[model samples]
Target chain A: MSEYQLPAQFEEFSQARKEGFLRAKAIKDSGGHIAGTFCTFTPCELMDAAGVHPVSLCGMSPEPIPAAEKDLPKNLCPLIKSSYGFAVSDTCPYTYFSDLIVGETTCDGKKKMYELLGRMKDVYILQLPQGIDRSYALEMWTKELHRFKAALEEKFNVTITDQALREAAELRNQLRQARTALMELQKLDPPPFTGLGLYKLLDGLGFSFDLHSNLKKLTDLTAQLQADYAAGARPVPPGQKRILVTGCPIGGVLEKTVKVVEENGGVVVCFENCGGIKPTRYLVDTQAEDIMSAIAQRYLNIGCAVMTPNSQRMELLPQLVEEFRVDGILEIELQTCHPYTVERYEIKKLAHDMGVPFLALDTDYSQSDVGQLTTRIAAFIEML
Target chain B: MPVYSIGVDIGSTCAKLAVVEDGRTLVHQMVMPTGWSSAETAQAIYDQLERQGYCPDSSPCVATGYGRLNVPYAQKTVTEITCHAKGAAFLFGTEACAIIDIGGQDTKVIAMADGVVQDFLMNDKCSAGTGRFLEIMANTLCVDPGTLCELARRGSGVSISSMCTVFAESEVISLIGSGTAKEDIAYGIVESIVNKVASQYGKLSVPGDRCYLTGGLCESPYILESLSRTLGLTVTSHPLARYAGAIGAALTAHGLARSERRTSV
Candidate 1:
């Protein structure tokens, strides 16, 4: 129904998106324990090393939020409500089949929702330290990572050896490398990818357990993108501005904004959310003597707004802006998301300092504001 | 012997059309309620304009506003934010200003400089600050929109604090039931709309003091007076403020047509 049709290769991912849970189901049936995580801070290497299937459990649909309202408040963050909604309604097999649901203390809404989720399934809480500059923060997170590794060993009854950790690290690094390689294609004029297309491919990483197959698909897709470029094929036409979206992660459930951005004549070239480049772009230094500590160091450097004094994020943005050739920045903060909302002013100031057009929009998962949201986004594109 | 570029703005409550010739002149303008069929209304307006000797094949047509996608013949669709800036700059000549557009379902505070849009913000999903909210309150008071604005102008000030439109309507009904004067309640409704708009405007970080009001709400004198008083700044509207979106769309169409002609040449 969108005015702009997605390129064929990206459309292929849409088919894969439909069978996401089935793939997870297949993995579960094959004697693999599925480990579901709420935040990207849950290192995939730890779970994979224990022969567990790691899947992201963030909910994207609003239909189940009413079911969630029985126990949760009506005005709670929509993502949290929708996630709990999926859990209660048994709509998400990933959550239902998860042997362990890993949660991080990224925000209060997710924290509280995870507490409620613990009643329904086995939940392991990751106590994330705020403000990386604090003297003991890195040490504290390192200890937490060890505890997390131990939990995986105890829950799965398999002692994780350094060799397995190294192997898992190598596997995940390959997946990350494939994703980062795909992202570089955005720097080209008339980016050979759509935001919706790129999102579908990256989101596949959340549910997919087999890194080698994903790398093959990505490698093949990248070749096709390069061929398209050589053949003078591009998804977005000239005069359409490139946008970099920053804010809440739009996972399986919260994807309308990306579609809306593309529909409104803007091509999303980069995403600063956890779902995109931030977590996947970095890799664990496998050569480090302690792979557990190396994984901790890598994730700790993630510049989420939950971190106090997130200067690394602020420092990284301008470089991304130049690298991606962004014409504007669209910062979307979900309703009741306090940390991102509080930090919105700083992002706004950054946009102004960089002299790029900016629009900070706050929305929930409800379809009511789609019209208004489209208008604002269109106007922002027109500005560019 | 001149071709006229056309722009149609199919808004939530009204559909507007503007025809421009020679890249500058506003040849014709039409405004009507959007009704159920935006595409039909836009087509009918286009037909009427075509009867006046405008050739469509040589001219570009642009559509904008909430129902923009429904405009069947649009060569391009732009957002009302761009249209408003273009329209305001045309009327006011590139002055650094904020264009405050209060439409049926939304209110947009757009910051512009040198005839270009720099930034903008729109009311969230709520209808509390929009023209539709005022229209609903007007219906409950058994008064037409024009009379309600006039009544507010003469009535004593009464505070109305409910943010949700449905609750605010209930609050209005209670005031009438409690022997409060209709005129006072009418004044409160106007103040409520003004308060909502002011709060949204306060959140804009774009630096500007000169504010221009556009959209159908500009026809309401009380809102303009209230806006000026609340913001403590000079607020003005172009004589054709209601046609801003259509005019901007028409201007863009003209530019597009010129580019096409140049490409062909």
Candidate 2:
């Protein structure tokens, strides 16, 4: 390890995943219900309202991939393969302890993988619409959320009242506000944390189960970073090209993409991917007459490539570029992920229109492409 | 006393060295086969510089290419993509143009404006559109790369569909077994490479009409013609195009040396 280390807050967040596993196991031991979720589109408020612990089950490693390949094809998305592999190998504690797994028809690869995952665990598939422009899309999605609520109620033997839903919505909205505040700290001239450090904290938040503690930790970290900045502490050097990363979820390949960018004289100031600002940018409407419909609208509006026309992503990108003062845009598409790969052309054109240099890279979860990634990222920094 | 800058490019297949005076005048240059080890090749380059009366201790040096980190004496290291763009701009004397560099392991399409790189695209983690693809096909056909290009010019009306180098080799074997003309098979191989490169170039939004070719295969007129025909643009190359990466590194070294001088004063 280098003599320079991440801040104590960052270290604690990095340890959240391992500690979360034990916390989740304890929850399961005490006859508590845990719901494993695969996409940001999953209504965690519904699970929270039913007094169930909602854990993100999207795999972020290459270890369980080979076991997944025994049942799934080799050329599918690595994220899908890793997620299914964990379920088949019985390795992930979250997947093992979950009373139910909630998946959505976001992409072809994942929806198929969920079919196989259902054999080992109780899996519920939510029929998601392809686009948000149509009138019936929201109605169908709201109905899906209702079905999901019903499923949760039947499985856990608990009634999710309107007041409970409202409370859950308010808590989730607070978490989003805390997350947004933490991420916005990168707008500082010289950011208080490295992009890698920021990404670790954001990715780690998914594994943490307690909503109140998660909100508290996020606000505390944001406050600490703001205080450090005011005290003349700059973790990232000035004049490093500020980069905005936009593409598929990058947790599995963060070391290759985000770490390489920081090491090569570029600091990723913003992430438009699933775990970053994409899902957290909107909040469920606690004051809506229909709380379930409000939750559906918030999730359906996420700027994921799975949506046709994907206008939300196109709309959100320029705002991030302007707000983050990005010097460059780096889009990472995992191999065989057709939606992000195909949508990259539009993103590149948008970046060009905004007069920022764009670089699109396609990679998998393996370490085989690290050298190439370094060279590409280094050259990009040099160009900036 | 005249100061000089040295640029060392340790590519996958060949190592090139260039010495420049004041960043504009090329004072010395050499090329050697990068056999087996890059560290050894870097040492050999330094020894050759010493013998040529160039002081490696005083000159500012920049290393580039796949083995750039192996150059122990270099003051800095830059990636081949940047080096190639800078060198191509200097050689072509055009600020607004597109460059296609077919390296041994990678093929890069770079767009430049005002003598700086605007955007670039490189082939994915495959040898489909690279110089290595042509080299492998040449070896399978029992001919050197140069002779293979020469033969490809004489044949017509055949194409290799496989995008993978390994699959393409087997396709070549089957074609040869069925008494297909060697020249025709060679044409198919070169055509496949040209098509792959052209497809990558098509994705890049360059500024101007000027397109230049650089790298080891730049000397091949047949490739230049095929690339131009496929891309629907005139693809041109210079005799020193193969050394573009080294020259770019040398230019960067000149900048480094000038900055150091300014800091010292």
Candidate 3:
């Protein structure tokens, strides 16, 4: 391993979740409202405008899966099982403190899991369109945003004004801009931070509700990294094969995929997954005539596998490959994630056309396949 | 003095060693049961090399396979995937071909173009499509793997549906209880593994029509024929195909030795 140490901010970001739990408890004690979101499609601006804090409650651990399997099928996606498991077992403080939990019809597993989740908590389901190419997708998503806004107002008893929505959108856009700038720093010859470091920071940002503090921390970390690099600190060794990770959300499989890749002659320079460039690259247009429609449009354009004909992903992949100077593409699909697993063929074809080697690994949040994953990833790095 | 390069492949079932003279000639080869401990197997391989008048410590050596890390004397270690691809390419004397290596724990299908691995796929963490699956089924049938394949040649009119080795073993026991012919049950076992391998091969977009077979099953003509028939392509193997991983490791050792000499000069 390289003896280079990550800045203190990376550690601080990784601990954000634990700190946020205490913060959420304090807010609840003071009679403040908190909303829990499960997907990237949630219009968090509505929650912000209604004086409610939105915290991401997507499950990225395997501890609660067995309990979830009692209610959910054993063959379902681990993310769904984990999320449902946390809620049913009352293990997650965020879920317990949430005034309302927002869910979107992203995939079959999550859609059904929400049905059961709704029975447990104050759940509100947003009917998301499956395809972005149709004209009705934007209109329907816009209407859903309005409905979500009304739900928040009714539950919190605070009417959200258009100016408040616009202001919330502007603050969220600035946060996104800060995240994008930090992510693009990996485009350097040798990335300033390892993929694990970058992932921790990005995943940690979702739990942090203070937008201004989050933005400041990101910029400060970016500056620290740049100054260190200028002073001849290369955290990643030169000549390691640059890898770009794409597919399902990678928080559950980070040790098996990203960490293994880095341990064996390669460095993960880019992550096109949910927590990385995918959701951060697009910003809500705060200046549009209707801020709700602009927010809906931006969220609808996410390159998720749930969307049929995910052209945004197809388009973004090649651009990322070139900009990152990627030598290989590794797609990590969780077990039973049908949309990403099925979409792997198209991603492979795209990698092949671009003259890059691609490898797809289907795994669950278990340690049983670590040996096999190590050999496969090591051989892939050797091939590059 | 002539400097020989050594390749050691400590697989799950067997350990193979190859010594190459000046990177081109196959000067010596050896194979032995891997036993329960890879570290002991590696020690035995070293002792055998010393008895054969080869200085393992002095020679440039590369270790491979699942137990590659256990070889203490190896100068470097490479994964079985690259070693197998390089060794099969050398044995078949072709730069562009697909290689299917069925080992004790896993089955790997690799596409080689211009003497490099273009793409590859392995069976998921299951023993269904691998050589271990056959061995377990053979044990249940009271026959060795070779005899089971031989029995498969004459049997027909039966099939095994379970892809899992343990489940398939129970399925075979039930067939025995039902008075199903041993030959017919044997045929089902071979068919199950052959079909699994064929399906895995179908997943890769191989570059050439030529496909090569390597590993322990390479010596079984019935397996070769069954795989060839199932894939609709002539899957060929040589007598030394089982030693491809070791040979590839030796070849890598040769390259490293040559480069070190150049740098020293």
Interface RMSD of 2: 5.8
Best by TM-score: 2
Q: Evaluated with DockQ, which candidate comes out highest? A: 1
* Tens-digit per-residue lDDT, B1-265, candidate 1: 6668887888889888888886688888889989888878877777777787775545788888888887666778888888878887777665588989988888888888778887777887889988899889999999987788889988876888899999999999999999888889999999998888888888786556889899987777777898999989878887788899998988888867443422100
- The C-alpha stretches of model 3 lying farther than 4 A from their native spots are A1-21, B257-265
Ranking by lDDT: 3, 2, 1
Q: DockQ of each model against the real complex?
A: 0.49, 0.47, 0.45
For candidate 2, write residues B4-59 as lDDT tens digits: 99999999899999888888887888889898999999999999999999987678
Give me the displacement of residue B39 in model 3, in angstroms.
2.1
Where is model 1 chain A poorest over a 10-residue stretch in terms of lDDT? Answer: A1-10
Candidate 1, superposed: residue stretches over 4 Å from native: A1-25, A252-255, B50-59, B206-208, B258-265
| Two-way DockQ contest, 1 vs 2, winner | 1
Q: In model 2, where do residues sit more than 4 Å from their true spots?
A: A1-21, B258-265
Q: Give per-residue lDDT, candidate 3, residue B195.
A: 96
Model 3 DockQ class: acceptable
Candidate 2 structure, TM-score to reference: 0.95
Q: Each model's RMSD to truth, in Å?
A: 5.8, 5.3, 5.6
- Cα lDDT, model 2, residue A139: 97
Per model, kept true contacts as a fraction are 0.74, 0.52, 0.42
What are the per-residue Cα lDDT tens digits for candidate 3 across A1-384? Answer: 323223233333436544655677777777788888988778888898998999888888998899998998999888889888978876676886788899999999999888889888988999999999997999999999898888888889999999999999999888889888998999998899899889988888777777899989999999999999999999998888899999998898899899989888788889998888998888988899988899999998799999998999999999999999999999999999999999998999999999999999999998999989988998898888
